[model samples]
Target chain A: MSSWEPDSDFVFHMPTKVLYGPGSHREIRAEMADLACDRAVIVTDRGLRENTDLPARIQKALGATCVGVFDDVEPDSRFEIVDAGAAFAAKLGADCLVSVGGGSSMDTTKAISIVMTNGGSIREHLAVHALTGPQTPHIAVPTTAGTGSEVTNVALIKDEAARTKFFVLDNQIFPRTAILDPTLTTGLPAGLTASTAMDAMTHAIEAITSICRNSMSESFAVQAIGMINGAIRRAVEAPEDILARGTLLSAATMAGAAFCNAMVGVVHAVAHALGGVCSVPHGIANSIMLPHAIHFNAVTDAEAYAPVVATLGIKASSPLAAAQMAAARLTELAASCGLQTKLSQVGVNRRQFQEIADKAMADGAVLNNCRPVAGPEEIVALLDAAF
Target chain B: MAVVFPTAEWVAEFKKQIDEKPDYKEGGKGWREGVIVLIINAKPQVGIDADFNIYLDLHEGQCREARVCSDEEVGDHPFVIRGEYDRWKLVVLDQLEPVKAMMQGKLKLTGDLPTIVRNIDGAKTLVKCATYVETVFIDE
Candidate 1:
């Protein structure tokens, strides 16, 4: 094989079976039958359960298969909740897990599967490839357009006692299936719609330029970026536009799949650190740091961003110029969507910058960055720039 | 080159550089973990007859100890990173990120992952300081 094919020797893992489009949630019955799962536990957050009809809709779709509902998952889901979710699922004898809502809900479901099967604190299972053995099957029904948690093998479950977010990455934890229904997202306000799409865009850009990127991952990232660029504005403006929301949903999933293989870079590292350390919403944190990270990577791997520049419709004469244009366009897009462009705008104090930088340097995503980071000092400088 | 990596002189140089470099000190001040053992696997062409361990006790921004020791001597180390000689060479020469190398499976990391993640700057600083050693590579 040609040297251009990095993935020829590499493994590409995409185990999550996706059922997308309008009303795909109805396919849960068939999926359950396919997985030979008789009982399912629906995982969701209280906010989504209270605010949306998603829980009732999911129950109606599941019919007799839905044996239980664990609606206690919080945003940035904690280990205790996952433990409790696992217990609840076990009590109900749930053979399958159904996640409804966004990243937190889906992640909670993933964590539950781990604890249910592994029988330990989630902390013990916090390293790369820490998990082994079969997991109770999971089906994700994403209610938001970001996180792509539906397709990824990463679960960022927070440990409340440690005051740190621990990520669990294992192919075993990937949901067996995902249901993407854009109608569930129409109720998402303009702000959330914008922030989520920005998050998806961050995933795409980071994946596209990630050092571990391959042809397949790049194709997914590029397509995701293009779709997000084309449909984000409409999704935010019209909120109820099924086509636009559908496009953003597809983009988010594609970006998720891309980053799952290619992995993300500094943007995710910083954003994840923000989520862990400061309780910042992942989407907002990603949107705030995305442009600065793009600029940082562009300084060294400017040519890597040609696809992003072209996808964003930025005209430029050189690689650096293209990178700059892409970054500028991203900033403009975020601003137009009323998302905060500065970290300071989102209540992250200057005092916490050093700690956040330290965490970012340690994040798994930092390893996948195209341009090798010197250490926390460089990250602190980046944080300061974003500030 | 000032020293050849995987040698006693290189470990000493690494400790000295960590002490002398203000950036390393500042970046690693929050790292309180102790005892990191670098297990370099055997490479026949490079004169490595057997796998050896480099023990480092990093305490709140200071390298309390840095030395080459036998595998049996790597006692009570909280973090132990094991990898092939070539991968270690790449890391010491600044061609690869230590964390990246671990993720790519070129390096095997065993320790408290959260604390390590929290102290990632220290990890990077440790690797970055090695790059400044002006070391000689056996392959080169």
Candidate 2:
């Protein structure tokens, strides 16, 4: 494990089979059939359920295969809700899960699957490798271009009582198949589209700079970054532009795959903490924190960010300068989509800074940060700068 | 006149330093848990056993108690962060980042990872407080 060598003794997990295209959503029934699953339970949010005819369309596609629709999933997946969803699935005799929405729906289905198979509360499976048992197979149909929960072996579940967010990390949790249909994301609002695409970009940038990055992860991350940089503007300007949506969808999945192996850095760390403490949305937090975390890492590991800068179309004489340019470009792109660039603008108070910094330090993302964090002062400084 | 490592005076000095740092007090304000730093391979220069533990009663931005825990008391803490003598020395000497060292498996952690993570800022502050202690290593 030399300093320069990309290869290391790493175990790469690629279990999700991706079905990508303009109309891949229709492949849901066939994928379920291939998995020997007939009774499919659709887990989604109330917003998606009312706004789109997607549920009806999916039910019609599944015909007799569709057994139930648990549309009670909240914005951030919660334990009680997921537990109820598992009960609904069990009552409906669902053989498999069809998650239809953004990260919330996908993560809800993952947690429900764990409960369905393992027969325990979401709390038992919060730590890494906590799920030694198998899970009910899940097919994720993402309706948004962010989260990348379909391919990643991680699930973010919040405890409503504690008002704190926790995660389930396991190799067995990746969806058996991911249906990446661009049509599902065409109806998303411009603000959401921008934030979501920025989320994918953050995933790529962080993965490339993660300490555990390998060649395979780097390849996926670089390609995802390029796709996102080239197409996000078009996707935001013209929501129905199929090509841009398709590219963004592909990029999100690619970033998901990349980060699953390479892990993510401080951007995700601070973002997760913000999401927990301030009630800031995940993509918005990622969007606001991306540039700050990038600049922070670039100061120490400039060479690691060279490919990231290249993907962002920034070329400079020095790696640090190039990285700075890449961060600036992201800020510009985020503003173009109507996303805010500061913490105070998003309702995070000055008093909460210390708590946010504390939570950020606790996040697993801090461990994978490309550069060593000096301590809480450095983290507070980063938060203050972002603020 | 440096305080020797693994001494009550050193622990007392470390506690004083922690109380003096505004950042630690602010960053660890939400934390209400006890942590034990267990060290193994006590150097021959220190007339201690092969293993000893430092108990830190950290709660709500204050170090309420700091003392050496007997072997029977090590498991009583809500959080226990363990490592060898060399790794502990490097961390206290500012030669290693405590969080990174734990993530890299240079230090071992037990008892509730998520809780420990939620207090990560405090943990780092604790380590920072350790480095601020002017101590003479037993090996040195």
Candidate 3:
């Protein structure tokens, strides 16, 4: 026998190191040393840095090698933030970038990392796998458990020109190390807690039911679904339950990883539209549209949703039942958390529904949904039903 | 005697409809299991105190086993629901009960989410099927 490896039919490629647990939120100097990151800059939003000494703490942990901080990242961040971040990093001669805070900050870091290496505007680097250039070491530290920003290879960058959100899907965006620390999320607002948790739940379910989902992705999605279902309620009701918060953080990161390898569906696309159009908060927008989107998708893609429903411990008979159960459960969870389910309730009108639908169709994420949803007619119908 | 064709009788008839309906049969092909439903008139707004447990299992697109049980003898199956009969009737009859209400536990839900989602259309089919054979005050 030659003791050689045989040709395989399947392979899973995941390179990020996930360090989780209580207070694993320290500076990544030790990890940076491993990744050969000597000059590092922490990318964060002003809100996170507001009257907080956390950045100093990171500097202390990282020692004298820590570069200057780029604190201009904003929620629903524009691509200019990416440019500014890269320019700042270049000025400081930073070799590594660490993101702290939620989706906005992490997305900024991913965007900056790409442009800094590729030498162009974010628009030029929009296509999937477009960045053939080498990427600098980027570590994502997600403060919230929602966007799953740390592990996803996709970065949602607001295209201010097109007036719609566009995502950059490239392997370069996936963080080298994702540090899941529940402590970092302790400062999150109650509303954000519910919204982000729901967003995480959406990611897991959408991934589980996505058209491109394979068995491995499904397994990860199921675990994430169960965890989010159990954890979101607790985190919403009682914000201090570190264990539950940690579980949600873990679920979000895992979902990001799972969906990064796979892809998300229409709910994300619709939510992104809300962001680009109305500026509804990302997580809240996703939470509002989730069940309706699930029900809509269920009519065409119920079989794909079975495992997700099963993971949530729903009792059902067929694929349609599984999808219904998931949708129904999401509604229940939403009500309990005081989250609104209707688009009308959220100040969106019928006209905007069609407008959002049009925008959603143009969204790149919607192209990856389990089934092809054509335009605003059905989406308008679904939105009306949700209302 | 065909079970007297009351609500219970309609339950059987409902099962028969699901078996006969081509769309339902096709949609429910992968569904082969039992569900126990707990119908409760918690608020009694309808002035009719109806509380009963319906044990049901669908075997190959047909509702094979069904029995209305006492509250004390709640059987083990994947589905259990507790809510006002008015809500259930509204859900079954009008088929237009607010979806958010049904999902948010305002109507009361407890069971396996996967099984429920997989059988949602089938569940709707079951409700419609039962209504077709019953003389209940259900209108289109």
Summed backbone clashes in each candidate are 0, 1, 31
Candidate 2 iRMSD, 1 decimal: 5.0
- Residue runs of model 2 more than 4 Å from their true location after superposition: A1-4, B1-112, B116-140
Superposition error at B114 for model 3 (Å) = 33
lDDT tens string, model 3, A242-271? 988899899888777667655678888788
The DockQ value obtained for model 1 is 0.17
Residue B96's C-alpha lDDT in candidate 3? 35
Error of 1 at B68 (Å): 16
Model 2 chain B lowest lDDT segment of ten: B103-112
**lDDT of model number 3:** 0.71
Model 2 lDDT per residue over A1-387, tens place: 112244453446888999998777777889998999999999988888898887777777788899889999997877899889999999998989999988989998998999899877766555454355668999998988978999988888887676667777777788999999898889999988988888998888888888877777888889999999889999999999999999999999999988888788888888887888888999999999989987898899888888887666677989899888888888998998889999999999888888787777777888788897766678889889989
Q: Taking the candidates in order, what DockQ does each have?
A: 0.17, 0.12, 0.01
Position A263, candidate 2: lDDT: 83
Tens-digit lDDT string for candidate 1 (A64-170) = 99998999999988878888898899999899999999899998888889888877766556655545477889999999998999999888888777556778776
By descending DockQ, how would the candidates be arranged?
Answer: 1, 2, 3
Cα RMSDs, all models:
5.9, 7.7, 21.5
- Cα lDDT tens digits for candidate 1, B1-140: 56877778888898888888876787688887778889898887888878868988888888888889887776566578888888898788777777655554557666655567667778888888887787886666
Q: What's model 3's lDDT at B120?
A: 50
Candidates ranked, most accurate by TM-score first = 1, 2, 3
